[model samples]
Target: MPGLLYLFTLCNLVIGTGAFVLGGVLAPMASALGVSVAAAGQAMTAYALSTAVLAPLVLVLTGRWPRARVLVVSMAVFALGNLICAMADSLPVLLAGRVLMGVGAVFTAVAAGIAVALVEPQRRGRALSLVFIGISMSYVIGLPLGAWLGFRHGWHVPVAVVAGTAALTCGALAMALPRTISAPGASFQGLGDLLRRAEVLWTLSLTLLYFVAIFCVFAYIGPVLQALLPMSTERMSVTLMLFGLSGVVGTVVGGWANDRFGPRRTLTVQLAVLAAMMLLVPLTRGNHALIVLVFVVWGIAGFGMMSPQQSRLAALAPAQAPILLSLNTSMLYIGTALGAAIGGPAALTVGFDRLAWVGVPFALAGWLTLRLGVTKGASWRPA
Candidate 1:
């Protein structure tokens, strides 16, 4: 189980690296492809859009296959997509490649499904936490490394690194997992049934709201920092690194809290704290040291939300955990896309001074919704 968990962690690292590379390489990619930086940034939108739309559909369509086989194939496809990005000479080609990466990255749901399937029920929260921590690790290791490679060589080099990693991860999964460990495949009707449940729908909505709040500020985090602190780019980079490191701790602590106190109480408290964090965003102005403290707290709240939400969904629909988890991932991406879209306008209008405050209602609303919709130990099996 430990070895298998490590493999899934690596798989998640690959997924995270691919998802984040666009942000780091947007400038170089735009320069190389002869497109505007904003145009190059559209590749991120394309990836998020495709991931949101395709993840569940692809799971249903391929649900019948052996899970390990599906994972291998997905990773292969992801590698292929990154390879395309590495060689792309035009914006359209890059967009197409990003779409492919989105399709392939849905395999992350497979990784989570495998984690839950292999672990004991009591330890499921811990297992899910390990799976999610990989994303934070990407920020800690993969994203920075890729960004550095892009700065040193070219944008293509960073993507090429991801392509290589995906290929290796695919190979590792094939060698590590046994053939007997797979769920029965799903039909479109199966997915439809899962979606019709009130709990599932509402739970997914909460997940969406959580990310929308975070990304609304996160999308404009750079300018927000600049407005408040007026620091050098190096200091800004270091601040972000510290935030990412704290997030790694948050993921672990979130899982432990869920296991100890139950998801409902843990998540409610976390969300409430998250709302408080947003409320503090406006206070960081001109206080560089204070801003650092605030960001650390923000990172803790930011990545901490995943474990409880994931544990909730897995508990609600164990049989459909893979499909449900895939949908959760989609909702998160949709929130990210919407948050970025909303952030642009909010930054322009309210300015970053109050931009952090803009996301406060979202966090509060999510907390309120969770309080109403999810009860302590209140999980319902899919009919």
Candidate 2:
């Protein structure tokens, strides 16, 4: 079981790297595809949107399959998508490849769901959290490394590397897992039942807006940072690595705060901090120290919300945690889609330096909705 869990973790690392690598490599990808940076950025939106729609659908459809089969097949699709992307010569081709990757992106949610069912109930939470380590590590290693490689060798290099990794992960998962391991099939209808509750919708909105806030600036971070303070490729990679490191720190802080103060207060503070950091981006002009400081804090606050948001959903409807968690994942990707969709145009119009500011309204909107949710069912502390 432990070995299986580790495989899932490695699986997520491959998936997360593929999902986020574009953020760091967007500029080069744009040049390679002969599109503006913003257009190249839409590949992110395409990937996210495809995942948003396909994740739940794929999960439910494949619910009856062996976990190992599902994992291997989905990962194979992801690998194929990356290969398509690596060879893409036009924006449409890149977008098509991204959509294919999104189809395979369902692996994360399915893995999470099965992780819940497969583990002994007592250790489920710990096991689930363990699976998520790959996600943060993706940021720490994948994003920056892809950025560095893409910059040096052109965008295709990183995509090709990721494709290779995904292929390897597929084989590893197939070898590591039980042939007959199966969990209850999911129901998209069941997901709809959760959404019927007003509180669930409202709470889910917070997840959407929060991610919308995070990804808007994040999707274009490479260009945004470059516009502010130009740096060599090596320096940019280091800067991105620092940002990723800070996110890991923030995830820890979020867990601590949730334990002591509860998810609500922890998130409230995090959201406010994130919003302020977004606004602070433009003001960091001519100030290297300030930009560095803001990006670090922003990384902390932005990533910190994950722990609480999941906790908040669990607390909202205890019996519904599993599905709510899955649904929240859907909302998250949807938000990612929206953010990337919005960020590109906003970056073009508002200018890259002001890109962070575009996300400010989203953060505050989430903050206010969260506050309002408390009046109905959202609580300050988990009861």
Q: What is the TM-score of each candidate against the true structure?
A: 0.89, 0.92
- Per-residue CA lDDT of candidate 1, range 212-260, in tens? 8887776555557777877553566566667778788888988888888
lDDT of 2 at 294: 95
Badly placed stretches (over 4 Å) of model 1 are: 24-40, 151-154, 220-234, 352-354, 375-383
lDDT of each: 0.78, 0.81
Question: What root-mean-square deviation over C-alphas does model 2 reach?
Answer: 2.4
Candidate with the greatest lDDT versus the true structure: 2
